[model samples]
Target chain A: MRLRADLVPQDNLSYQDVVLVVDVIRATTTATAFLEAGASSLYLTAGLESARAFRDDDVVLAGEEGGLKPAGFDYGNSPREAKEAPVGGKIVVLSTTNGTRTAHLAARSAKHVLLASLYNAHAAARLAHQLATEEVAILCAGKEGRIGLDDVYTAGVLAEFLQIMGSYELEDGALTALTTRRAYPDPLEPLHLSAAAQALRQVGLEADVPFCAQIAASPAVGVLEGRVGEALIFKRA
Target chain B: MRLRADLVPQDNLSYQDVVLVVDVIRATTTATAFLEAGASSLYLTAGLESARAFRDDDVVLAGEEGGLKPAGFDYGNSPREAKEAPVGGKIVVLSTTNGTRTAHLAARSAKHVLLASLYNAHAAARLAHQLATEEVAILCAGKEGRIGLDDVYTAGVLAEFLQIMGSYELEDGALTALTTRRAYPDPLEPLHLSAAAQALRQVGLEADVPFCAQIAASPAVGVLEGRVGEALIFKRA
Candidate 1:
C-alpha cells in the first residue's frame, strides 16, 4: 500500500483501499486509551472551535493546542488525563492541532480509515492488512510544519512491524520510515537536538520514549471511517 | 543543519541553512550537468501550461509531466536528455511533475538551495558546507509523493560528510539516511526495497546505486545554488 506522511492534509486523500491515520505521540495514544477505557465512539473535529461548539449530552469535549487544553474544554490531549477522565459510555468531541486534522483528512479517501499509535501499532497493522481493499497509506501527524522525530520514529517502528509481516506492498511513507529506521537503528540519540524533541524530553517524558519505542504494546486500533460524522474504530474488530 | 531526503517536494523540508535537492532518477543530476555546462538559471514551474507560456530569447523552456516532454518544451526531466541538449549560456525554464515542483517548493522556505545528484555529490556537499548559514536540509525529489531510495541514499552520503564536519545538527531526515547507510553498506542489496530502488533494479540502474553509495569522490563537492523564477535552488540557479 501507499503510506504517505505529508505535513499538510490534502482535501482529496487518495485512499481507496484502507487508510490508517497515526497520531502516535499524544493524540491517537490518548484516543486509544480513552476508547479502551470504555469510552464510546469519538467525533473528531479539525479544530478547537468546532469541538467547543458541540453541545451534545454526555459527550466529553477534549483536546489541546501547543499542549494546552482549549479554553473551555473538559479535557486535554494527555494519556493521563484520558485515563482519569470520566469518558466511558459517552461521545467525545475531540480536536487537536495535527492528529485530529489528519484523521479528518484521511477519512475523505479510504474505504476504511484507522487511527494508529505506538499503543496500537500491531493491531492497526493487522487490521490494515486484513481490511486493505487496494493499498494502505499510513499518515503520521507531524508537528507544526516540520519533521517531528517522534512521528517519523513511530512510523519507522510501525514500518518495521509491517515489513516483517511480509504480505502487503509498502507505499512510499512506509518505505520512507522503514529505510529511515534501517538507516538509523537508534533514533533517540539525535532527538536531543530538535526543538520539539527537546521539549518533550525536558518534561521527563523519557518514560514515554521507551514506552512508545517498544514495538507494539496495546495493539488497539482506533478508526475514523464511514459517513464522517460518526467516528468509530472497531478494535480487535 | 537538518539534512533530509524528501521524495516529494511538499512541505516538512528541513530548514538547514543549505538545501540540496536530489532527483537521482534524472532531473537534478542532469540539472547539475546543465549548469556545469554553462546554463544560466532554471525556472521551475508546477505545470506545462506555465512552462510553455514562457517567452524569452535567452531562456530555454524545458521539462515535462508523466515522464514525457510537454508538447512545446525545449527539454525533459532526464539527465541524459539534458546532457544532449544545447543549454550553453541560456536560462532553462523547467517544469517536471516532481523535481521542478520540489525545487519550487523548497525555494519558498530554504535560505539557500542547491541541486545534487550522483553525478555531483561531493561537489554539492563542499559547497553546501562552505555556504553553511545555520543548518542544511536536503530535499529529495521523489517519483510522485513517495520518497525515492536514490535520493535517500544520496542524502545518506551527504549526511555522513556533514556529520564528519562536526558541530552541525542533523535533522531526522538526515539522520535517517546516515543510519540507513550504516545498516546496509552494500549498495547492490536494494538496501531499502523502496519503489525507486525497485525501479532502478528494473532498469539496471542498480549499478548507479553503488556509484552513489560511496561518500564523496574523495574530493568532488557538488555545490549548486541558484534560482529559476520565484523558486531559487542551489543547483539550478
Candidate 2:
C-alpha cells in the first residue's frame, strides 16, 4: 500500500483510493465529535448559505467562518460544543473556512472520503487502511488554502496508525508528516503551534485547540455516504 | 519581519517580497555550486529545448529531465559536477524538472529572488533577511508539483538562519518547515529519506544526495540579476 500526505490540497488526489480529510484545529475534530455525540448525520457544505439552507427543526446549523460562529448558527465549529449538545439522532449542517470545502473537493477525486482528526485518528486510519485498494491519501485542510501545522500533525498521527496495521510505502509528504508527528509527541503542541490555533485564540476560542487534540477520544470515523446537493453527507462508519 | 515557507508552490506568493527558491535535491544546489565555482552567470530555463538553445563555446548547457542528463547536454543537474566543472567566467544554461520553472514563477511575484539550497542555506537566508521589505517566503520547488522532504527540510534550515539574525513572525508553513528541520538534525537523513534521493539512487547518482546536503558548503548566494529570453539570469551576491 502507498500512503501519501498532502500538506495542502495539491493536484495529486486522482490516484488515491481512500482520502482522509483532516482539519484537526477544529473541522474534522468537531464533525467526528458530532457523530460520536450521537448526531444521526453531518452535512458538510462549502459555504455558509448552503449550510444555513439545511437548517430545520432537527438539523443543527454549526460552523465558523473566521474562527467565529456564523450569525444565527446553532453552534460554532467546536468539538466540545458538538460533544455536549443534545444532538442525539439529529442531523448537523457544517460549514467552515477550510475543512468542509476541502472535504467536498477531495470527495470529487477519492473513492472513499473519511473525516480524520486527533479526535479519531486511530479509528479513521484503521477504516481507511481496510477500505484502501492501493493508496490512502491524508489531505490536510490547511487554513485558507495554505499549509496548516495542526492538520499536518494530525496527518502524521493518522499515518502512524495506518503503518501499524499494514506495510505501506510513504511519499515525501507522508515522511514530512511522520517527522512532524515524531517532533511533537503531545498532540496539543502542534495544535497550539498552528495558525488555526492562533485564529481561534484571537477569537477567544482557545479551549478548542486542546479540545481538538484529544487522541482517539472518539471512535467515530465519518464516512461519506453520499451528497445532498453540493453538501457531502457523512455518517459514522 | 515575517517568515513563511511554502512547502509547495501554493497561490500565496503575492505578499512576499523576498522569495528563496529551494530545490536542494539538485537544481538550486547545482546553480549555487556553479556560481561558487566562478561561473559568470547561470541562465535558468524551464524546458530542455530552451536550455539546449543557449549552448555555445562559452555557454554550458546543463540539467536533467527526470534525474538523468538529457542527450547532448553538457552536464546533469549535479552539485558535484557543477563544483568540479571548468565553469569559470562562463555562462551555464540550466533547466531541470522543478527548480528552474519554480524560480521563473517566483521571479514574477517577488521583488528579490534568490536560489537557495543546503549548499548556501545560511547565506541565502542572511541575504533574504537583509533584502526583504517585510515578508520573506521560502518557496520549496517541490518534486513535480508535490512537496519534497528535502526542500522543506532546507526551508526549515533557512528559516532558522533568519531567526538567528532577527525576530520574525512565523506562519504555519514556516512552523512546519522548522519542525521538519528539527526532526532531522543530520541533514543527510531527510535528504536520503526524500523521494528525490530515491530517484537519484535508482539512477546511480546517490552521491549527489550527500553533496546537496552539505550545509553552507558555498558562501555564494545566487541572486536573480535579470532575464535572458525565457531564462532568468542569476549571479553570486
Candidate 3:
C-alpha cells in the first residue's frame, strides 16, 4: 500500500481510501481531549452558525479562528481546555481553520474518516492498518492554503508507525516524512512544530506543545462515523 | 519564493510556476536525448494518433507504451536509441508516463515552463530560479500513477539548490522534498537502486543515474514557449 499527502484547500478535499484528518496544532488534539474529558459527541461544522445552532441543551459551543477561540464560544481549539474538564456526558460543537475542512473532505472520499492527533496516534495507525483496504492517505491541515511542517511532521509520525507495523511502502511524501523524522538529531524535539503551538504558548498554553507532541498518548481511535446535528462523532462504522 | 512538490494525475497538469515533468525512468530521458539528437521540434499528444498525425518528413513519431517503443515509430523511450544520432534540426513527437503530462500542467500554470533532467539540472535550476515568481512547483512524474522516488530525488536536488541560493523558501510539497534530500546520508547509493532507477539501468542507461545524481552538472535549462503541435520545446516566453 502507498501513502499520499495533500495540503488541500478549504473546499478541495480531494481524497480516496482512508482519509486521516489532522489538525495537530490543536483541532484533533482538542477533540481527543474532549472525548477523554466526557463529551458524548462533537458537532464539527465549517461555519459558526452550526455551533450557535447547537448552543443550547448543555452544548458547549466551541470554535477557533486563526487559532484562538472566538467570542462567546465556550471553548477554542485547546486540547488542554477540552481535556481539563469532564465532558463525558455533554455534546461539544467544534470548528477550526484546517481541521473542519479536512473532516468534510474526508467524508467525500473515504470508506471511513478518522481524526488523528499525537495523543492517540498509535491507535489511529493500528485501526487504519486493520481496516484499510487499498491505500492510506494522511491529509494534513496545512496552515491556511499553504503547507506547514507541523502537520506533515505529525502525519509522518503516524505514517512511519503504520509503515513499520504494516510493512507498507510509501510515496515520496511519506518517505520525505520518514526522513524528516530522522533529521532532527534531538529526540526531544518533534519532527515538526505548528503555528498553533506557538500561538498557544503566547496565550500561556506553554505546556500544550509537549502534550500536543506526545505521540499516541491516547489509545482511543476517533472515527467520523456520523454527523450529529453538524458535529462529527467517533464511532465504529 | 515558496517551493512545493506535487503528484498530479496525468490528466491534471495546469497549476504550477515551473513544472518539472518527470518521467525519470524513461520518457523524459528519451525526450532529452531526442533533443540532443537532431529533432527539429517535438510534438506531445495525449494519444498515438496525434503523434501519427504529425508523422511525416518533418516530424518523427517517437514514444512508448508498456515500456518498449510502439511498432512503426522511429525510436523508443530509450535514451540510448536517441543518442545514436544528433537532434539539432528535427522535431521529435513524444509522450510518456510523467514528462508529457507535466509539460501540459506546467504550460497551464507557469509563465515560463522548462524541461529538467540530470543532463541539464544545474542549468534548469538556475533558469527556474531566475524565472520563478515567489512560487515554484516541481512536478515529479512517478511510474504509471505512483510517486516515483527518482523524480522526488531530482526535486530534492532542485530544492537544496533553491535553499542554498537564498532565493526561495520551501513550502507545500517542496518542504517534503527538502526532507527527502536530507534524509539520506548518501543519496546516490540507495536512491539509484530504486525501481525507477532500475528500469533505466535495464535499458543500458545506468551511467545516466550518476549524471542525474551529480549535484549540478549541465546548466542549460529547457523552457516551454508554447504548444507547437504536440511536443514541448524550451524557449523564452
The models' CA-based lDDT, in order, is 0.63, 0.90, 0.67
- Note each model's CA RMSD in angstroms: 4.4, 1.5, 4.2
Q: Best by lDDT, which number?
A: 2
The reply for model 1, stretches above 4 Å from the true place, is A1-12, A55-57, A164-166, A183-196, A201-207, A225-236, B1-7, B11-17, B37-65, B68-95, B109-111, B186-237
Query: What tens digits encode model 2's per-residue C-alpha lDDT throughout A1-237?
Result: 999988897554464589999999889999998999899999999999988888789999999877888999999888889899889999999899788878987898789999999989889999999999999999998987789999998999999999999999999999999989999988888889899889888989999888888898788989999998999999999
Candidate 3 — what's its lDDT?
A: 0.67
lDDT of 3 at B41: 53
Candidate 3 Cα errors over 4 Å, as ranges: A1-19, A132-137, A143-146, A163-166, A169-173, A185-210, A228-231, A235-237, B7-23, B142-146, B185-219, B229-231, B235-237
Give the distance in Å from residue A47's predicted Cα in candidate 1 to where it truly belongs.
Answer: 2.0
Give model 1's share of reference contacts: 0.39
Residue-pair clashes, model 1: 31
Docking class of 1: acceptable
Report the lDDT of model 1 for residue B83: 56
Candidate 3: RMSD over Cα atoms? Answer: 4.2
State model 2's lDDT: 0.90
